[model samples]
Target: MNLQSILSQHIIKAVSESYAATLENIEFQATRKDFEGDITVVVFSMLRTVKGNPVQIGETIGEYLVANVAEVSKYNVVKGFLNLVLSDAYYLDFFTSIQNFNSYGKVPATTEAIMVEYASPNTNKPLHLGHVRNVLLGYSVAEILKAAGKKVYKTQIINDRGIHICKSMLAWKRYGNEETPQTSGLKGDKLVGNYYVKFDKEYKKEINTLVENGFTEKDAKAKAPILLEAQKMLQKWEAGDPDVVALWKKMNGWVYEGFDATYENIGVDFDKNYYESDTYLLGKDFIQSGLEKGVFEKDADGSVWCDLTDEGLDRKIVLRSDGTAVYMTQDIGTAIQRVKDFPDINGMIYTVGNEQDYHFKVLFLILKKLGFSWAENLYHLSYGMVDLPSGKMKSREGTVVDADDLISDMAATAKEISEELGKIDDFSAEEKTQLYKTIGLGALKYYILKVDPKKRILFNPEESVDFQGNTGPFIQYTYARIQSILRKAASASGYTESVEIRNLTLEPKEKELLKILQQFPDVIQLAAGNYSPALVANYTYDLVKEFNSFYQNVPIFGAENPAEISFRISLCDAVGSVINTAFSLLGIQVPDKM
Candidate 1:
């Protein structure tokens, strides 16, 4: 068991014997820096049961703990705070026990599974800066959950069929003389996205022309020839028109190829993908079931809706009056279908923007009202919008920050800054190029993932790529420095992976580093519980800071004895291993020689 668990157990025993108090919960916090202790037990919380002077109660408990616990060498009481000073042998024993730091914090997988859905992008446009946040958050949370011993399935639902999709298709057909992604020398998604923008431009012009000719703006918008044709195309596609279906297949195929490239570049992958074309019609049957069960109400016009008035939400439409499924219907069907596909999956997390927060709330409630056992496990990982330093992005007007372009720009920025700093002097051309991308993408992912998901981000690419402070490059550089130290130590001693030194003394900085390392498993569990990657990201930064302090104040290679040098080298290896593992969880890469 961990030291904290051991301490808690002994402390409870002491309270029961000395104070005769049957306490169920014990609150522990970091020892105040002003106090000479490692962990502080809050004596204030025990006053209800023990009914005595808090200081005296603390002193009695501390005396009992120091007398009984091997790790607890001594203790002190500051008011109601019972501060316990643990022995150095305890830390050394703990460090020696964790032999494989690479997988130290991870737990064995359980039978129950979780499904995390992220990066559900539309085929109409390429991914943007906003999609970056969604994917990073989802991917990191999935990793955190897996580390916490839960089986996880990563997935996405592609928005490949809709009126917006038809707009792009119609535009490509009207404007192009048989141009393809290969012919245009552009990615399929980007080529299709250009047409989507083109359709909006032409549609606006048509609307203005009709309005000038004495039509209302609404009428003009509805009556625009291009939009009407796009609507007709959607109807035809829905009706399984042969030519329209073929065009859609061909265009969507291009988009899938393009999207695959982007997802690969972003270092995220899905185990399965659900398509709108296949799943859009799924929830109709569920709607009928809900209506039969009185979970939903059927209006006089034949529309199906769930009345959420008592739940503080307005009525939500599941099916239209024309017997067509809405997004809500499709979502409900898709969720049920997933359960059918993966019987072991007990929960699902939908990584989506905060704009649809109400949508998810209503969806989850309706599912619960319909009496699905797993409905209670549904969570919407709602995140705020991402804005660039320049301004907000609009995809239709082509002012959006394309994911591919942003990634490339970040790499180029890394190259510029690295060359200016002269940090890659000993690297070959190929190594330099790879390191640049690693550092660049690392910076981007870290800058975004470190912030709380609900907070709006004003992304500054330049600021993010800096090789100092709490950035990804900073942590990566520390890992590289450790790597360099390990290489030198290995060469000097022909070092093996053994830490046999049992009697070596540790400095204050070394003990501080060990203390932070001890918190890794707890941090992983906490991050998973909160479904927050920010917690993991910031924890990693703190670990790096602690390691840096140790590196600065202690001597690793030039230790007083061979045992001390070996122990310090072992500590360095463990820190590097953890840094690599943590970065891997965030989907960021750390270079060995950055």
Candidate 2:
């Protein structure tokens, strides 16, 4: 079922005897180009201080494979690379295997439970483009891991408490006297975001008046009553001040309402969510536990700190002198809580930004030092920032793109393009709506996941990703086309023609597409193995590209032999299934027509 395992078995059979009966992990990797064949088995790692050259070693392996491996019909030895040519029968079996199982493309199930925390945003503002990147990457990674058979629990800890949130609330109280989202015709989060921006303007003006009398920025910030009141507001809400709690709930609900639409549009959701307001006290208890075990020490200022100086890290304050929990403290407690809640969990993956790489390193290490063995499985799935083509987006300057607005604009643009390209001419209402949604989301997800996660992407709105070529909609459309061909073939065959692919004519197009399909399971495994959904992104694009090439060159069901017609039709169906499965992983859907 796992393609890589089977291929490695074939490779080991070919090369193990030459390695003196001691070789393991034959290391057969998929090739990028078709000329090199599907799977290339490397022989260098097996040879150490060898008397024979790598070229000679490769030569022996290739010959052995061609002679001994029945599935490998041909072989080439090129610079320590053994490129294998799989027999048509192998592809025939693979096509039949996948086609027989309607759920063959579904992610296999596993007993290992995982908690993936991502999209941890404050309730003060509308979601931004950066959040989009985080959400999609998180969603895709969850989908990939699930595909590899993991019981995944998606979660997020909302930064719903603190001065940042109060800034928005304060501005609303001062300037928005009884105005609501319904009255203003603005989204709840965007309406709240307007006040967040307003707060910065007022804060800057008030701070300037203070600085004119020689007050430093820090002193001016301290002197600001609004800042003090915001902190008081947090305390009041915590101590069961009904009025303060009511206001907090009202504002936070507005943000959540807007966020739900964004999450639905992007196709990302969580299994559970934690609020900072609810879990802050839990952090203090964990700090006390750490102190009791000598994992932390109270400073002269009465602040609890974790001494990480030996690790070239700063001594981090887990709790302030006033006994309030810091961000790191809350994370520690939440980690403990989740593991306790789901003791059978195999791992916890925090899909966070690379800026917090050091933070996660310390957190994981501290958890281990505190005697949590499962800390070893806790991973930080960090990704680079998504900056604009001009530079990074600045929120205080009000240049940040709103997530809802951006998607709406993209969908509108997509609809316009659809009309221009005549793709919308023959569609019913539902069909047109589906096409629009598919194109919109496909473009967005593909653009975000196309690059490697660690590399920051420079996104330019003007030079946006195209739907006509090398884009998600291109793949989506191609998939629809494949389905169309299959439908036509099925009707012509009277829906009962099942052909034996054992003698499928090995045309160049058919062979290439077959090989690509055979590698889908490995693509899923590798994507899940490296915790990178970009692998699936790349694989899906490559598969679509191969399918297009095959379509342009090979005419299916036009051949003389019924065997050839049925074989080609089934293979096409297999290709469509692969594309559908792949699209689902990236949270993109295939439109039946486009």
Best by TM-score: 1
**Cand. 1 Cα-lDDT:** 0.90
lDDT of each: 0.90, 0.80
Q: For residues 1-594, could you state the per-residue lDDT of candidate 1 as single tens digits?
A: 766788788878888887788888788998977889899999999888877899998998899888889889899999999999888898999999896888988888999798999878899988998998899999999988998999999999999998999999999999977899889899999999999999999999999999999999999999999999999999999999999999999999999999999999999999999998999999899887898899999999999889999988999999999999889999999999999999999889999999999999999998998889999999999999998788888998777778998888889888888899897799999999998889889988998899998999887755545557989989999999999998898788545566576676778888888888888888889988888888889989999999998898888878887778888889999999988888888999998886
Please, what's the RMSD in Å of model 2? 2.9
On a 0 to 100 scale, what is the lDDT of residue 313 in model 2? 87
- TM-score for all predictions? 0.96, 0.92
RMSD of each: 1.7, 2.9
- Model 2 weakest lDDT span, ten residues long: 99-108
Q: State each candidate's clash count.
A: 0, 0
**lDDT for position 178 in model 2:** 65
